[model samples]
Target: MITEDSEFLKGVKEDDNSSFKAIYEKYSRDLFVYAYNIIKEKTVCEDIIQEVFISLWAKRKTTTITSLKPYLFQAVKFQIFNHFRNNKFSREDLTRLNIIDVSMNVSQKLEYSELDQIIRDHVAKLPKRCRHIFVLSRYHHKSNKEIADELEISVQAVKNQISKALAFLRNNLQLEEVAFISLILLQ
Candidate 1:
């Protein structure tokens, strides 16, 4: 029998069903474990693993993975990071900086992701460099030096970019405007 990794490589290269099944059966548990380590939320970890596999299968023909295990685990890690990074709480923390009260209601729960997406859409419109600096500082909580190193710029440049971006956002958004946007985006 072809080794499981070999099967996956073949499927990824050839779109073969048997190889795909072998790949799924062999790696699902490992993928789940990897995702759990990064995500810590059981439900979210499971979701990440599922999405990883679905994406793997969908993109199999175009993928050129030399090592199935590491590639899958890294994919899981990236997915987990993206989910938490995109979660509503991060956006709320950014614009509101206030503690939120959660109630036990389906509608309330369902509104969060919608709001996050809305805010993300607006943030995406920001200039590319400004957006990168802002997210690194706000979401990733990186220091100026860290952001500078990551972006391969001077620390002063990092600080200047953040200041300019914040000033622009503040000018464009008044208190009421920010509050309204926050409520609508984070509803």
Candidate 2:
């Protein structure tokens, strides 16, 4: 069955100009806002979205876009990330990029990745319920109530399991300088 949702993708893949225009009109504003929020520059955000659209149009015949919205947003995200990475950041600029650490030195990013891997290993060792709750909270970014509902547990139980998991990680891991840089970035 050809889903109504994918009509646009199919039209685009078949080199239909109206489909490309409709897709742009639908997603461009939201994409621009997302890029602007991350980059805090109007011109750069505009250019990024333009580049994303142009790239999408170019790749339409060759690439499969099952979900148009994510493909658009992900392209903008990569462009924004590239902008941050290619350009030098002042300490002030670094502070504004939010929790994303584009300013991290190569070695610091490496340390951060190593620390993250170690933490994931320890998370895997947790009891099943605790690990599930913690993964929902951290990796999946779910609220306590949401996790509770999904797991059929009390909100307090969700909180307790997340807390227990965090406490376990704290005891097991030695987060030092590299992690401190991450903390500073978050602040």
Candidate 3:
């Protein structure tokens, strides 16, 4: 937790309205924009933000928040994901939301959408352990050390597994395409 947000979390846990409002004011706009990017619906995005803040306040006392910013963002993400999932979204639509890379332009996002589908198809063929590690490192953005800790494995093993996964992807994808995907995904 950052020192600043830790203070907010402490105050919120003690039912301080000002602390809760401070956190809301700081994050709500950013959260709305983030949700809007994926959802592209202003009303839905606003509702998701409201729901996230409400959930945060409702659970402040019981939830073990290690990082307040990430927890709040993730809550908004969860709501959006569920909204898509429960509304009969196609696999491609979900994939578009699943890879929310704001760095890409409209055309690149379309291109990546097609490319992402291809990569996912190939990634599905990976061994279970390799697939899990790759998803953790690329999709979830977990550090190799963090993944190793969570998986109860050595850092060396994590590195070797990631190497194997990348090698497998390189072999299966366009000879040079995985390089581009890796650059973005590894970020």
Candidate with best lDDT = 3
Task: Give one digit per residue, the lDDT tens place, for model 3 in 18-48.
Answer: 9999999988997787678677899999989
Better of 2 and 3 by lDDT: 3
Question: Model 2 reaches what TM-score against the true structure?
Answer: 0.55
Clashes of each: 1, 0, 0
TM-score of each: 0.44, 0.55, 0.55
Better TM-score candidate (1, 3): 3
Ranking by lDDT: 3, 2, 1
Question: In candidate 1, what are the lDDT values of residues 1-187, reduced to their tens digit?
Answer: 6666876678666868887777888778766765564446789878888898889888877877776766775576467546644675554444543222233267755665554455566667779998888777655445688899998999999988778766666566545445423222211
Alpha-carbon runs more than 4 Å astray in model 3: 99-187
Residue 115, candidate 3: C-alpha displacement in angstroms:
17
Residue 186 miss distance in model 3 (angstroms): 13
lDDT of 3 at 63: 95
lDDT of 3 at 187: 19
Candidate 2 lDDT, 1-187, residue by residue in tens: 8765489888888899998898888888988877786677999999999999899888888888776665676677668767876798765554444334445789978866776677678889999989988877766545689899998989999989888886787677664522332221111
TM-score of 3: 0.55
- Whole-model lDDT per candidate: 0.64, 0.72, 0.75
Off by over 4 Å in 1: 1-4, 88-187
